[model samples]
Target chain A: SQTIHQWPATLVQPVGSPLSLECTVEGTSNPNLYWYRQAAGRGLQLLFYSVGIGQISSEVPQNLSASRPQDRQFILSSKKLLLSDSGFYLCAWSPRAGATNEKLFFGSGTQLSVL
Target chain B: GESVGLHLPTLSVQEGDNSIINCAYSNSASDYFIWYKQESGKGPQFIIDIRSNMDKRQGQRVTVLLNKTVKHLSLQIAATQPGDSAVYFCAENIAQRGSNYKLTFGKGTLLTVNP
Candidate 1:
């Protein structure tokens, strides 16, 4: 069985501070990874996705970025965080084959509060 | 510019009753759909999915119905229980250029099953 792990279940960061959130998957290789953010009472917004190492695609212009350092390790980072960057960040993965219509498995998520 | 939207923001039902959640989408090019359940402070979990070629699919006690003619989708839960209380979201997969695809999610409907 495949499982995803996300760190820092809850985070409190000051404005203009650097941020890093890590996610990793086990039991799978070369899977598609994605990062999403959900604001309070709002729907999810896709931040970035990677089909392979060093192949990140941004869905929207934002203050954050994502990287795939290894086959199953993905990281979300920001050089300087803003108050508007506060939200619940999620990491998800899907099988690379026939990924266009595959369902995604998600991690527990990281709730970041920027004050 | 296309997006997914829900018909209701909240629903309350008695335990052991059936529950139905509705969603609407504006993108006709979407070929895949999914339903997800999210508890507070946790990531969304996949509940069910259906493709454009299929009108309905069933899993466990849940059913997903896709009406491509009206671009409407629905999720039905039989004998809803208190554990079924959560936010339900519908997502659509739109094919992008090349082999890329993107999922657009709806603002979730909060379901509360009373015991």
Candidate 2:
């Protein structure tokens, strides 16, 4: 089974501070990676998705960005934080092309609380 | 681009009782549908999924039913537990949408299992 890892189970950042959240997958190669944010009491909002290394797509333009540096590594970053950015950050991966990508497996997640 | 939605914003069921949550989609071409569970301050977890060809798919204590004719989907938990209390989201991916297989998620239903 594939496993996902995300850093800092929870984070508290002040407005305008730089932020970086990392996500990595083990036992899977070239998996599609996604970054999502769920506001308090809201549904998962797609932020970014990456299909391959050095490639990324933004679903919703905001203060956040995503990058895939390695085959199994995806990173979410922000030059400056916003109070509205406070929410639950999630990392998910699906099997890449021609693979048995049935469902998305998620990481434990990182709760970001911008103060 | 068609969208997916849920019938209810929230649902409450007693522990050990069966819980049912409903969702709706506008795209008839969607081939894959998935249900995700997200706990407080956590990321969405993969619960189960069903394809359009099958009416049902079962997993540990959970089942997913896809009513493609009516464009409706549901998740059934045989014996809902406190651990089942969370926001449930339905996502759809239609083959026609493109190779990226971008998923469109519903607003989601908050399922609260009462003890």
Candidate 3:
């Protein structure tokens, strides 16, 4: 079975501090990885997605960026976080078999509070 | 820009009763849909999915119905239980300008089960 891991579970950081969130998947290779953010009482907004290593597609223009260093390792990073960047961040993976990749498996999200 | 939306923001149902959640989508080009359940402080979990070729699909105790003509989607839970209490979201998948597929999610509907 495939599983995704994301961390840290919760974080409190200063407004100008750098941010790094890591996600990894086991039992699968060349999977599609995605990063999403959800605000309180709002829908998820897609941040980035990668189909393969060293390839990333950003959905929304923001201070955040994503990178897939390995086949199953993805990282979300920001040089300097802003107060508006606080939210619940989720990591998800899907099989790369064309249309069948519609179903996404998500990891327990990270709760980031920028103060 | 096209988006997905839910009919209601909250629903309360008695335990053992059936629960139905409705969603509306605006992008006709969307060919795939999925339903997700998110408990408080966790990521969205995949419940079920249906493609444009199928009107309905069933999983364990859940069912998803899609109506392309009316641009509506619904999720039905049988014999709702307390464990079923969560926020339900509907997502639609559309190709991003001939690139990889992207999902547009609806602001979730909060479902509370009363015992």
Give all candidate RMSDs, comma-separated: 1.3, 2.0, 1.5
Off by over 4 Å in 1: B97-99
Error of 2 at A65 (Å): 1.6
Tens digit of per-residue lDDT, candidate 3, span A1-115: 9999999999999999999999999998789899999999888998999989999999889999999989999999999999999999999998775555368899999999999
Please give the lDDT score at residue B44 for candidate 2: 77
Query: Model 2 segments beyond 4 Å from truth?
Result: A99-101, B96-99
Q: Please give the lDDT score at residue A17 for candidate 1.
A: 100
Q: iRMS value of model 2?
A: 2.2
Range of the 10 consecutive residues with the lowest summed lDDT in candidate 3 chain A: A94-103
Instruction: Quote the lDDT for B64 in model 1.
Output: 98
lDDT per residue as tens, model 1, A1-115: 9999999899999999999999999999889899999999888888999989999999999999999999999999999999999999999988885546888889999999999
**Model 3 lDDT on a 0 to 1 scale:** 0.92
Q: What DockQ, between 0 and 1, does each candidate earn?
A: 0.71, 0.58, 0.63
What's the residue-level lDDT of B105 in candidate 3? 90
Cand 2, B chain, TM: 0.93
lDDT of 2 by residue, A1-115 (tens): 7889999899999999999999999997778899988777777778898989999989877988888989999999999999999998889888777733267788888989999
Where does model 1 sit among the CAPRI classes?
medium
Model 1 per-residue lDDT tens digits across residues B1-115: 5389999999999999999999999989899999999999899999999999999999999999999999999999999999999999999997766555668899999999999
